[model samples]
Target chain A: MNTSSNDKQITDDLMPQKFSKSGMIWVGILSTICVIGAYAYYRQLRYGLGVTSMRDYVSWGIYISNFVFFVAISLVGSLITAIFRLANVAWSTPLTRIAEIIAVSAITFASLIIIVDMGRPERLYNLFAHGRLQSPIAWDVIVITTYLFISLFLLYVPLLPDLKIMNQQKNKNSAWQNKIYIFLGSFWKGNSEQVKISDKIINILCIMIIPVAFCIHTVTSWLFATTYRPGWDSTNFGAYFISGAFLVGAGGVIVAMYVFRKHYHLEKYITELHFEKMGRIAVMLSLIYLYFNINEYLVPAFKMKKSEAAHLAELFTGEFSIMFWFAIMVGMIIPIFIMLFKKGRKPLPMFITGIMIVVGAWFKRYLIVTPTLLHPFLPMQNVPDNYKHYFPSWEEWAITMGSLAGALLIVTFFVRIFPIIPIHETITEQNEKDHSK
Target chain B: MKKIIQNRYLLLFFVFSSMLFANRSFAQEDAGQEIVKLHYYNSNNSIQYLILESTLKKNKVFTPQKDKTYQIYLDSAGTNLIAKVKTDAAGKGKAFLPPTLKKIWDASPQHTFIVKAGDEEIISDFIITKAKITIDTLNLDGIKSIVATVFKFENNTWTPAKDVEMKVGIQRHGGVLSAGDEETYTTDSTGSVTAEFKKLNLPGNQKGDITLVAKVEENEFFGNLAAQKSVKWGVPTKVDTHFFEQRTLWTTRFKTPYWLLFMAYSIIIGVWGTLIYLVRQVIKIKKLGS
Candidate 1:
């Protein structure tokens, strides 16, 4: 095909399409869940956090676990978009938008879930009005806000060229869709200067986002680590959290990549090669996370200090033993074993592995937050028997699931509104490959 | 049909009679198990009163019999009624000896008190004796001692009440701390017990003043008597009222540590400065396109 025809075909293939019947059903289901979650939040606001099962001892329940999960999953944007771009990995070009949207949506809900966790959501102003600098909570607020903005810019800057392309395809979009394209990208003339400036700023953001992403999760880890609690007082917590975050974030991206590739029939662009590479990365991340898990748990188990003994025992052989082992074996070990083999790196197997990792990682966060809270340094005294254990009430579960559904809805709408794969970059890369050949 | 109706009526009558019989038996047993206690208290100002408590035992539980009335008399023959006491919700009642009993009270050193409830009477008699306690402080060459003496008025003379047991201690809000290792001290033949002060560096008021207390509690003859003496035997404590004003991690938001504030603000400004620049650059991109 001639250059002009080839470019036109790429744009035609990559432009946003209307949702199919299944897609509409998916959206409807997600909207229902979101509505349910909204009602749960309303109940939480109307009554109090008493609606949740959290009490004095197990104050940090699954809501906090969900928050950590969202924060952990958000790190994939940095991994795929910034780290891969800076490393000049050519194959990751098609997956950048998927990772970036996941990061954006997850972080958005991370902030929302925190507000839902608050008993007095109206008192949120206290965080800024009287926030103490010495508090790790204050540090987390600062870093998360900074990371969200940087991730947004990273997502937006790369889309300018694609937005301009979508705007030119006037007959393909509705009137409102065309207006949205204009409002977002009418200023993008795509001249050499604009492209140059966009490239420079994207590079700046790529570097700036790496540390901010690390700080976001590390400071979140500090929120627990700075406490004197048994399961949380390790110096290894920050690196441990960061490694686990990368694993889960990569799992999220891999899952997204597979879903988009199959649903959109972009097998030619996404390719088996992409899955193989991501599988390899997931394996490496899982192994590194496994190493850190050993460092976090094994050393403490060896000494078994009186304070840490009960917490470690609960995780290793006590009430949480089943979940603890599931998170380790399924989240890290089994995925590592699966992806290490060449046959297991296929798209379907990789997808299953990704699901395993994500589910296991969620339970891992729950185990991390709850077991330690149950085994506090002080002896459990005079509290209700229910206070000594934690299980998310229906409201907590609905709200958490709703937040998850809400995040998925955002990504789903984003996919319907914009090309899941970057049209301009894919074309440019294709052109470069053809010229080289 | 008439015989059946008569049999039915007879069965109903028997059931009601049995229920009434059982209820009356239970009431009698409860009344038989009722308990009463009387106590006398003579205050430091020489005013005296008596307290009465009534309770009933049922099913291994003691329940207060509230709103019950008891009559107090100066004799066993139900004559010379001194006062009528009524119980409150706690099953306790209080009454003072009436002015009419003054002559009877002063007529002898021994007196009898009688209390009467419905179908029950209790009598208690005791010898009334007046006693006084005197506490003295001695700091001879820094060997501080608390000496307490007990004297009883007998035969119109004050005589030493030897072998009397009393508690000598430094006074505290909750209770008294023993001046030494022993909890209580016994008086010698001279009616005095000396307790060596052994608490070291005890904190006291700004002037190093500590109140030493000597108490003869619930004595059979003396009722209860106590004396106190002030001594200078503590390390004076001066509180620092300005502690909260200092900048520290535990302080209020306005008093956050300077070093922390500086570090946090520096990091915030540096990071946000870059973000502001990036925002300005994006606006510039929009302008450039325009």
Candidate 2:
């Protein structure tokens, strides 16, 4: 195709489209789940955290697990958008917006889920009012907030040119939609100077986000590792958490890629090659994560140090054995096994493997948080029987499911309003390729 | 059909009335089972007090009955009213024996204390007696001992009160520490009980002075009597009161370590400064577009 025709085709293919019947039904289901979650949160507020099964022993329950999961998944934005951009990987251009939206939505809920876990949300001010500089919690607060703002700017800066395109295509959008586009991006005149400055700022943000992303997850890991608990007291926790975070984030992007590609009929854009490449990245990340998992468990298990013994036993053979083995086998081992082959790297198998990794990573976070809490250094004395075990109540499950649905809803709404694929960048890249030809 | 409906209505009325009466009767039974305890206390032969406690049993647990009123009388007949007290949240009511009853108390060798809560009453009688305790310290060959003697006024003469049980210890802030292993001691025929000081290297004030205390507590005849003596028998140590002023991790936000403050502020300033510069650059882009 000629450069002009290619640009036209790219723009036509990439413009945001109306939802289909299934899309409408999907949105309706997500909305219904969100409403139920909102009601559960309302009940939690009206009553207290007692509405959940979290007690003194299992104090950090699935809500914390959900928070960690969100934080973990959000690292994909940094991986796909920032790291790939800085490394000069041109293939990641199409997936940048997808990764950025996932990061934005996941980090947003990470913050909100923390508030839900705080039984008295009003006392949230105490975190700022009486914040101690030495507390790891304080460090987490600082880094997570900084990461959110940086991620927003990173997502927004790249979209300026696309917003200009959407603004120009007035027939494709309603009057109100055009108004929003103009309000957000009318300043983008697409002059050479403006493009130069935008590129410079985007590069600066890309560099800045890498360390902040690492800090956000590392600080989250420190929230556990800083404690003297048997399972969490590890020197390798930061690396362990970061590796797992990258794996889950990459899996999340793969899942989103397959769904958006099939739904938007973007087989021409998100091709089999992207899935194959991502499959390789997933295998490498899974192996690194597996190494960390072994380091996290094997060394301690070998020692059978009286302090870590109970915690390890609970995870390996005791109450949490089923979940532990499931997380390891499905989250890491099976995905590694499946994605190793050439056929498994195809879209359908990769999608299934992605789902497995994401689900397993969630349970891994739960096991990381809860079993250690159950096996405190101090024996479980004088506590009620229910305190010794943890199972999420209906409210916790509702709220957790609601958070997941809410994240999907955000991605869904984002796709409906703006092109999920960056139109301007895609056109620019396509023109460059055509010119080279 | 009308006759059957009338009979059913009559039966329902009987069942409902019986349930209501059953609930009322259970409540009345619970009310009748309120427990009242009366205690008399005379401290230092100067202050006399009457303490009354009220409680109710519910679900096999004794729960305090707050805001319950109780009347104290000085006689079994309940004629001489001394004080009226109300229970606090802990179900205890306390009142000092009023000066108005001093004449009646002085005229009698024995007195009856009565506390009445509604229809329930508790009576306790005590013999009026005067006693005094004197604490003495002895040092023999590097061994220190605390000796206490109790005497009671009988037949218009001061005589040693024998076989009176008392406690001899070194006085601490909240309670007394046993000078030796035994917690309590009974007086011999000479009305004296001795306890050897066994605590070694116990820290004390800068001057190394510790107060030795001896007391006869709640005796049937003596009420409560106590005596104390100060001795230089403890190891003196200086305390630093300005520890919190030091810069430490556990200190308040204001007292954060200088190094930590420097590092944290540096990161904050570095990151936020970059963010601010980026924001300004975006604004410049907007300006260029305009």
Q: Which candidate is the best by TM-score?
A: 2
Instruction: Give the C-alpha miss distance for residue B286 in model 2, angstroms.
Output: 1.0
Candidate 2 chain A lowest-lDDT run of ten: A1-10
Predicted chain A of model 2: TM-score relative to the true chain A? 0.99
lDDT of 1 by residue, A223-331 (tens): 9999999989999999999999999999998898899888988898888999999999999999999999999999999999999999999999999999999999999
- Estimate every model's Cα lDDT from 0 to 1: 0.89, 0.90
Best by lDDT: 2
Superposed model 2: Cα runs more than 4 Å off: B1-39, B42-111, B115-169, B178-202, B205-214, B222-237, B241-246
TM-score of each: 0.75, 0.82
Output per-candidate TM-scores for chain A, rounded to 2 decimals. Answer: 0.99, 0.99
Measured by C-alpha RMSD in angstroms, how accurate is candidate 1?
8.1
DockQ, Cα level, model 1: 0.54
Clashes of each: 0, 0
- Please give, for residues A1-437, the per-residue lDDT of candidate 2 as tens digits: 67778877888899988899999999999999999999999999999999999999899999999999999999999999999999999998889999999999999999999999998899989999999998889998999999999999999999999999898899979888899899989999999999998999899989989999999999999999998999999999999999999999999999999999999999989999999999999999999999999999999999999989998998999999999999999999999999999999999999999999999999999999999989888898987899988899999999999999999999999998898899899888887886787
Point to the candidate with the largest DockQ: 2
Model 1 residue runs over 4 Å out of place are B1-171, B176-236, B240-259
